[model samples]
Target: MSVRDLLVLGSASAVPTKARNHNGYLLRWDGHGLLFDPGEGTQRQMTYAGVSATDVTWICVTHFHGDHCLGVPGIVQRIARDGVEHPVDAVFPASGAAYWARLRHASAFRDTGVIRERPVSGERMPLDTGDAPFRLVARRLSHPVEAYGYRLEEPDGVTMLSGELAARGVRGPLVRRLQQDGRVTAPDGRTVTLEECGVTRPGQKVAFVMDTRLCDGVRELADGVDMLVIESTYLDEDAALAAEYGHLTAAQAARVAADAGVRHLVLTHFSERYRAEDEPRFAAEAAKAFDGEITLVHDLDRIAMPRRRTSGGGA
Candidate 1:
């Protein structure tokens, strides 16, 4: 059996509070895992989350921030220590090559497996790893350092109408041709249109944005996405600080989600000053502005995507 999910590894900002860890996440799909922003102590965090280095197929770092990529050396060392034979797909900002090189050789260790670097810089995204269910697109975000946001979209499928097929006398042999050619001529010399028997449904999309302020990239990435996981490093009261540091507050993220048509808004990357008691107020403040489902993330919280439904209440 295969499982697909986004595991919240750590959700704190630059500082790790007692309750919150640093910035880390693991997207698991089809028995493969992609770790994003493995912050400090990610190895132990993974162990606590029941994740292993062997399960990882990719490592994506949004930037070279100490809180985002500091754990890379440890994770790489673990792979080497365990002698993983499989290659690890690595993605980061191309401009951060120096940082990657330093982290790659932060300590003396053997190369565990193949390390393929998939760096991003501009609007366009590189090719997918060719294994995931969705196309991964990267867009530039408003961050002091070089940073980008990623969006994943699955392909749409055609919905067949059983009643239409039966009325048209389409059977096993004829149905295949109708599907392949989008048409079929019956013995009665009647033509059948594909649209008369089938309908097209839109695909699901997911976006991840972090360590950035409200910008066009946020709207573009979150547009029509089923789930939008973004950073909320501060509260609305400290909006000024958020701007100075290139971060978004809870309300700012909510407003963005409201405009982007995101189905679920997951606000994470919280500052260490706030505690669990403050999360409810923060969530409430965000909810006031955005009508979508809002979640103030906690480490190790397993969040499932809402079952497929019409877009924005059927638009």
Candidate 2:
């Protein structure tokens, strides 16, 4: 069966605590594994999360911050070490090309030439992923440094209405033909169109926003997405610090989700100032703004994507 989920490798922000490591998250969507914001100690964290270097299909870095891209060298080296045949795409801000080059060759090792550089430029743009099942887009974010966010959107499709099909006597092979050809002949010599027996099903969407203050890009990326993985670096009490450092507080993150109609809100990238006992406070603050599912993640947590919305229903 196909598996779609987010694997939390690490959740700490700039500093690492005994209970948390630097930032790292892996999104597994069927055959594609997108590794996002891999910070220091990501290799070890991946091992603990049961993720191998070969499983990574893409590495998306929001910025050149050490806590976001420091693990590039290790992951790249490990990819070469494992002799992963598939090409791994490395995506980041185009302005950070110099930093990426340094991290790509941080140490002397055999270069397998399997990692491809696909930097993101412009304010907002769709990335080329060949024939991937979903469309991937990048949008510029508000931060001291050049940062970007990513969104994955699947194509909308139609689901067959069993009741309609049975009523029309469109059973067995006729059902498949109706879906493929858009029309098929029923048992009573009647022609039935696909639209008459199917309802439009909106595609599933997920977004990743890291180390960015609230901005238009954040709203655009989170709009109606089924899952939103965002940074909540400070509490509402320290909103000033959050704005100064170009980050979001738990309440701010939740409000964004509520505004964008996000179904599952994942709050991560917490500061080290908060302790294990304080974790509940983050969820509590977020609950006031977002009534949907909220997850204050810990290292090695695996979160499943919300199920697809029912026909004619909102996510």
Candidate 3:
């Protein structure tokens, strides 16, 4: 069985509190594991979550903030120590190349992992994930420092309907021929088209938005996505402070998700100022704007992706 889920390793904004660690998120999609914004103590957090370094295939950094990328050294070293054989791609702002290099080499432990560096420098760019079914896109975000958000989109495909196949009297080689040639001669001497036997399976999408104020890129990344993981570093009461520090309030994040038609909204990267008792306020404010499922993320929390959308059309 294939597994797909979002693993929340750390959920703190500027700094980690006693209960929360820094910002680290692992999105497990099929065979790929994309780690995002790993902050301090992320390695231990991964251990607690039962995620090994070998599981990570990509690392995405929103910016070079200490709270966001401080754990890169440990994670990179751990990857090397564990002898992760596959290539690990690291994506971040092009301007933060210096910071990434420093952290990647910080106390290196006999480097063995193949870490590819792909820096984002434009409005929107696609990262190379080899032959993965989904396309990885990055867009620039509005922040004091250069920041970016990521989106993963799967291509639409066709799903064979068993009932439709049976109705057409298509079986064995005829079904395969219909799929390959778009038309096949059935045993009854009737021609059957691929469209007659299959329904369009719209692909699923997931977006990650962190440490940015409201911007067009944020909505563009979140539009029509199945799940959106975003930063809600502050409450509505601190809206001005949030804007000043390049962060989003729970209400703002919720509004973005609502406008973009996101099926699931995950709000994280909370400030230490909000105590455990105050967590519900964030959810309440977000609920006011977004009617979809909203999750207030905590350390080690896991969220599964929703089912794929079904449609009647071409692949």
TM-scores for every candidate against the unseen true structure: 0.91, 0.96, 0.95
Per residue, candidate 3 scores C-alpha lDDT tens digits across 1-315 of 778899999999987999899999999978889999999999999999999999999999999989999999999999998989999999989999999989988883798649999999999998877887689999999999999999999887888999989998998888777878899887788888988899778888999999898999999999999999999999999999999999899999999999988999999999998889999999999999999999999899999998776684211
Candidate 1, residue 262: how far the Cα is off, in Å: 0.7
Q: What would the per-residue lDDT of candidate 1 be over residues 20-107, giving only the tens digit for each residue?
A: 8888888876666778899998888899999888888788888889999999999888888877777888889999999999998998
RMSD of every prediction: 2.3, 1.4, 2.1
lDDT of 2 by residue, 178-218 (tens): 98999998999999999999998988999999999999999
Which portions of model 2 miss their true places by more than 4 Å? 185-189
Task: Give all candidates' CA lDDT scores.
Answer: 0.84, 0.94, 0.92
Model 2 TM-score? 0.96
CA shift at 24, candidate 1, in angstroms? Answer: 1.1
Clashing pairs in 2: none
